[model samples]
Target: MRLKGKVALVAGAGTGIGAATARRFVAEGASVVLTGRRPGPLAEVAADLGEAALAVPADMADTAQAREAVRAGVERFGSLDVVIANAGGHGGNAVADTDDEDWRLSIESNLTTCFVTCREALPALVESKGAIVVVSSIAGLTAGPAVAGYVTTKHALVGLTRSIARDYGPRGVRVNCLCPGWVRTPMADEQMDELVERDGITRDEAYALVTKDVPLRRPATAEEIAAICLFLASPESAIMTGSVIVADGGATAVDLPTLAFA
Candidate 1:
């Protein structure tokens, strides 16, 4: 096991990519502390993971709560070898409709949460010479319509990841980010619903429209994304740091001219 004796802290571990990563990490031999805003889901995942996981419910958007979660993880595991800042979502609002609350929520949910968690866990990570994986999005690399706040936050995460990598690489703490394109998660499903309603298209049509630019013609599964996270957290990627691993079904790689036009 690449992570056999390591301790990991995973934010947003209740569901989606975070849950999958936590499960994968535990299976590969790491003690993980799972944190999420909801207690029931987090506790369920922790219970399912048996003694290898600890559920610590905390609202990661709050700086104090984020710090407390990290502290709880260290206390439970005695050391921290990996930190996965995976808590983020689309607090939906178009730029024209987005008020201060929408903008603040997006920042707190996606950007500030990562900063708070990383800031609190940096000391322990440095001590263990650990790795940090920030879950960003392809939206971080390119602009998306109608998601100004989310796009901005995700883009900021990439910069934040690079900053940490540059500052900590020599210090033995590796920092990197995963820039996933559209993945088949609950959030994606919800976004699809919104798209269907907004554009008055069938669900399948909406899916096809979204995947039209992707070379693979489909979104990634949650498991696929989790596998990449496992590799980044594992020793196999020891030499990899400060990189944005794009798992977007080739969405970010294709030229517009290559796509077949109807």
Candidate 2:
């Protein structure tokens, strides 16, 4: 068991990458606190994890809730040895099309939520000399056509990871960012459906086009992403900190302008 005595707090643990990571953390012997806005899904995931998991239904966008989520896990498991700030959704909009509320909500949900969770979890992690993994996306490392807000915030996470790493590494706490590309999740499914409806294409065709730039020809599974999060939190990556590990199936490695020749 990689995390035999560790206690982990996973935000956005109700579904997708967060859910998968929470399950994987448990399998690796960590007691996990699952926090998200959805109670039913949190309950279900916690049930599957049995006694090792506690479900805390709360909106991560709210700073108070994020802090409370961390506290709950520390209370139950004695110390917070790991924290995965993996809660986020796409803010689908063009630069000009994004209203103030859209931009604000996007920042709050993606960037601020991460900051809140990490800040609240720091003292516990500091005590344990634990690790923090912030989940960003490929969108954070590079630019997408119209997702200005997402791109901006994702990039912010990279800097955030580095900043926290520098400040806390001396104190024995490690920090890093997990940058994933398109993953086969509910959020990605919604994008696929939108493509199908808007372009009058079959689901498979839409999926193909969406993944065409990805050299792997498909998206990563939630389990795959979760596995990496496990590595980041475990002692296996002890020497790694302030790193932005991009797991994108070679999507970012491709040169889009020369794609047809390759």
Q: Each model's TM-score, in the order given?
A: 0.93, 0.96
Tens-place lDDT digits, model 1, residues 1-262 = 8789899999999988999999999988999999989999899999999989999899877878878888888888899999999998865667898999999989999999999889888999999999999999998898887889999999999999999999988989998899999887877888788889999998767777899878888888888998999899888899988899999999888876756663
Give candidate 1's TM-score: 0.93
Model 2 TM-score, 2 decimals? 0.96
